[model samples]
Target chain A: MSEPTPHSMSETTSTTDDDETQRSTAADPADPAASADPTPVPGETGGKFGRYGGQYVPEALMPAIEELTDAYQRYVLENEDGFMDEFRRRLREFGGRPTPLQHAERLSERYDRDVYLKREDLLHGGAHKLNNALGQVLLAKYMGKDRVIAETGAGQHGTATAMAAAHLDMPCEVYMGERDINRQRPNVFRMTLNGATVTPVTAGRGTLKEAISETMRDWAGSVEDTHYVIGSVVGPHPFPAMVRDFQSVVSEEARRQAIETIGELPTDVVACAGGGSNTMGSFAAFLDDETVSLHAVEAGGADLSIDEEAGVAPNSASLYAGEEGVLHGARTKLLQDAHGQIVESHSVSAGLDYAGVGPELAHLVDEGRVIPVAVDDDHALEAFHLLSRTEGIIPALESAHAIAYLEAGTDTEAGTDSEAAGDDGGEPDAAADDSLGETVVVTVSGRGDKDLESVIEETAARDIDGAPDMSAFTEGI
Target chain B: MSNRAVSDRSGNSEAIAQAFADGPAYIPYLAVGDPDYESSLEYVEALERGGADLIELGLPFSEPIAEGPTIQGAVVRALEGGMTPDRFFEFVEDLDVDVPLVCMTYYNLIYQWGETEGPRPFVERAAEAGLEGFVVPDLPAEEADPLREACDEFGLDLVFIVAPTTEGDRLDRIMDRVSGYVYVQARLGTTGAQDDVSDQTAASLDRLREYDVPKAVGFGISAGDHAERIVAGGADGIIVGSALVDIVAEGVESNRSTAAVADRLEAISRELVAGAERGSRARSTGDPS
Candidate 1:
């Protein structure tokens, strides 16, 4: 099939004014209470997203949480001139900010959509995680804390934090699960080379959850001199709000760049959600823009269907299958069993292998501001290869979930052509109208270097007679 | 029965008030079902015989974030012995002991039972099982309204912790709602036996005395000297956990019989209880300075 021109695709959508009118009338735009107030009101107990977020920690850590919250409010938010300026300087000189928003031409043609890739994979630590790390480490310094600690699943956050600590001349320690350390060996080495002490946690299921619990324990003991720079938008009050504010630059820049490059905002914005930092960052700017739909793709592991008794397939989609419960200090949607014991999550991408998501995403999901979908391991693996071959950009397994959704035509309503663009199948597109063509932006949250081993192993297993039929694997799904 | 006048403070705070009115309270902590449920019961009985004023029953959880290695190991051993929340309550309901029992556990066990609705289920069950109060190490005073409300409705005192780092406003907030003796953390770290009482313990106790609640110092009071110093510094009770838990762990590691472990625990409990008595005498005589 011949590829359509970008101009032809752009012409298919309605005028910008008409689109804006339709979107404003489609639903009650942003919650005035949330959008109008930027800073946390004084005496507000916990930084809440609707009713989803709260500080549910032990008494031993309350004083520390209070101290950190005070410091963050006074030094970082109120006096941004002193702290945030230095943080932004470091982000520019050391962490490489203002990353390009590149148009994925070949892949866009294959999908018959105008797809733009926010190039966070080109960041200093090869992921968008450095944005939060640099900003938080700066705040730690401003708080007069000489030591820093963090927890990691795929080690990207650990590597980014270690790099920031090295730059700031602070002693850094990172807690990682023993299972994750083995899989993400390269990033672990990178963290060690940056002078971080990587402590391997062996408690519980030995994954991200255990690492976070261990980090909290360490902070409880050494709260005076150490600051725990939580990697994702999870955890207690100031952390989820702070990390999201630090990462908001991702969407802020992308929103401006989309208008500058394509004359208007993309019809839909997509990102992957684990603890939901990148998703929140990519969706924060467009939340008030009713015309732009926000979609988050979660790791599906095996299947996207729910099974309460067996709890087997699509084990990682907390928003889809989880109930409201408290975990690691926040009350959010958690993948828990009937007795409230947290169930172990399975995902090929270690970054998205958590059993809980950020409470803010939970609120957005509840408000219908954000749509969540799940893509299994098979589809993500296929997208990981397709992006490399078509766009010459190898995306992290977590980001590949977003690409997989596009390939599977699951997000056609949000964006893309309804004619089933890609080689998958056009038969499913007969029900929807093909006249409405929309532009979509997918966030390449990180580089795929850490996942090369798993990808090679998976490809080797799918090989038939020493030749891998990549198309055959992704055809039916 | 003639001492009934001293126990008339209030129905909810009677147990702690009576214990404090008599003398310094010596509280020993043991993880319930550690090693086994039957032995755990014997340990509690031995503590009561050894003159313990009250006992803290620990509910073992898979993740005890506020615990040091000593208590963490005990929790692991208890869970390995197939202890669950249901079994813990069943054993506690039938436990025969003289001293009042307060549960010391992480918040997740209670939170899991409540399941994001409220902490009423766990508090009600604990009350049904004869528990007098709860000390959730992780549920701070600021986020404790739900559990505190449940505790009040169930006629249970909710004990709150006052750490060395807890200062002016935060200390006042924690002390205001505390019904039982205030749990004063002697040091800046997790539960373990330290060589000496923290230098800040004296000042922390002095600050805690500004409030009306009785103070009990914990988180490293192992030896008699440590207990005496804490109580002499104005602490109404001395809370010891790791030292007693270490005895249970050591006994299990060395293949000692349950009776031997109980005897060892009782012997140490007697020494600490004597130290608490001496400290009480010093406080009454105004001689610690």
Candidate 2:
């Protein structure tokens, strides 16, 4: 009954990393997250950590990406003290950093498992997207790029990019897919109000790919004068690498706090994956530690059985239906056909709507260092509501996918309706104790403010229906 | 087979089909993601009304490679207006402009769609939605047969291009098998305003005429003057791209206030049409042609 006291909700999945620092000044020990690993990070500038974060761009855009890399390096090198001080200051004051490590007391008691959350939702911009956007925009300013261009899927990146650009007083342009524009209208309006030009792409299937293509086109046309700020850890070299480096703040903090609070490292690390930002950010530091199991849960919209979207089927399944090929200028697993043509990608979370993962994460997944799991939209929704009801914390729909994986415990049947309510109409609480296993920690990446309407509609519908319909929706193909 | 017929309902099918039969090369270009789909309908209607002789509707891919800044800005606007292949087809279907709507698009999109997998379903879907032809900017004349075959089966024109950089044997081959007018790249660049119409372009037109094809010069023929000079230089048709894209730009810039910008664009289009008509008349007479 007293097994580590089931880990206080705040101490469920602790990550205890060594405090040793790299000897080289090219490495910063004050930035403990970036200091944990001693391996060659991966790419040319930093260790690409598996080919995930190389600079894969057109020949014309290389100079721009390199310029950004160089500027970031120069800023980090010359103004280390100033930059880190400002980074930490703004992150705390402006970005609302050091978001609390909240213990889910009620959930821990109800499920008989310690469930703690690293609440990133408390960050400004309502998600973890700002972590990198702020870093990159500041780097762009340091690089002397007068303007920035970016692509958005559900408009989270667009809004974040616009916000960062506005704060920096740099002009911003966002390329969005036509479909995403309609689906995420409010974000579009928000970006426009923020003084960013919203260019709707009217080609192919109006989705993330179109948004990415248009971003590339815009960058190609203006690579000389603009910085193309990518949203996630995907894209070719440097981008996947750079975004992770910036977002690594999440894991860095998580690892430090885990040791400081729990006196050890966590047994497991879990986060959601759209373009795999939070997951990568949460797991990058712990990658080489063979003891910690890193889990990345992808959206399984309605049917957990299916690997892709229903109506608009795509060929990409970097984790499930992809092969190792080059796409968007980097060599990673691509969801392309034999001939290398891109196929549509599907995920419940707008942020995870990409067909590929960050190259570094892909390498880790390929090497079996990290475990990959898919959670359908319906279950993710359940996790979303569960976290809200249990902890009074509403997480981003994207982050909910990861929570679903932790709550469901890798067995699709574990979180089923029959398990929740029981076959003979027994009380729902009867199976609660049986379901709880180990200390479960979920990364609440961002606030659900952006997804509040959708969550309300989903929960309202579920309340009206009396139960979550398992058949009508489950994470599937 | 003169490019003088003007009827919104009819793009003078008999003349265009005859021109195809005579091996008259054609180059038709329109901003793919054009004036609002509503305005694109009008521009397509105008091309039909002006007897474009052979129509090329730019596919308005999210990434347009052959556009200058003016056309590029309009494309950005069209994309903003929810322009997708499905919506574009819907616009084409509703427009009721009966002409060979050759879809001028970039390569990556078609490649993404797996052109070899018979993008015909998409093309047929568009054709069913009332489109008639395709001219992907990146589809070289050498690899044009499959697209040509798909169009041929559907009674559509699979048009090809002859850039200024196109050489002798390739030129002769493109001229020989090209069905719709051979898309004559008037300049060494994308579709937009040019400083001046080159004399070398005139020489290229003459060289093309020697192949006995009705050649149409495209890329940057914007104003009435440019149209007149093109028609005077032995061009049977003057295809306008960014000029049309500019009208679209004007309409979008005015918060999409249709009437004023549409009227202004209509007038410029009419002048170019009239200028082309006059040049055609002069050439027929061999007097001031």
Best by lDDT: 1
Q: Would you give me the overall lDDT of model 2?
A: 0.62
For model 1, residues A360-405, the per-residue Cα lDDT tens digits are 8888887766777677788788888888877889899999987777
**What digit string (tens of lDDT, one per residue) describes model 2 on residues A238-353?**
57666877787787777667656655555567788767788888877565443455677766554323232222333223554455544565455656533344456666566777
Q: Where does model 1 exceed 4 Å of error?
A: A1-23, A26-44, A303-314, A409-437, A461-477, B1-13, B114-116
Q: What's chain A's TM-score in each predicted model?
A: 0.86, 0.79
Per residue, candidate 2 scores C-alpha lDDT tens digits across B1-289 of 1222222221223435554443222333456446567766766665555445556666654444445567667766666665666666677667765455667765434434424454455555655656555666644443445555555555555556666556565565565456655667676545677757777577677667666545677766777777777776777677777776676676666666665655665577677777776666666778544
lDDT of 1 by residue, B196-227 (tens): 88878887887876677778889888888777
Flag clash pairs in model 1: A58-B138, A59-B138
lDDT of the candidates, in the order given:
0.79, 0.62
Could you list the iRMS of every candidate? 2.4, 9.5
Candidate 2 backbone overlaps, count: 56
Tell me each candidate's TM-score.
Answer: 0.88, 0.58
The local lDDT score (0 to 100) that residue B76 gets in candidate 1 is: 77
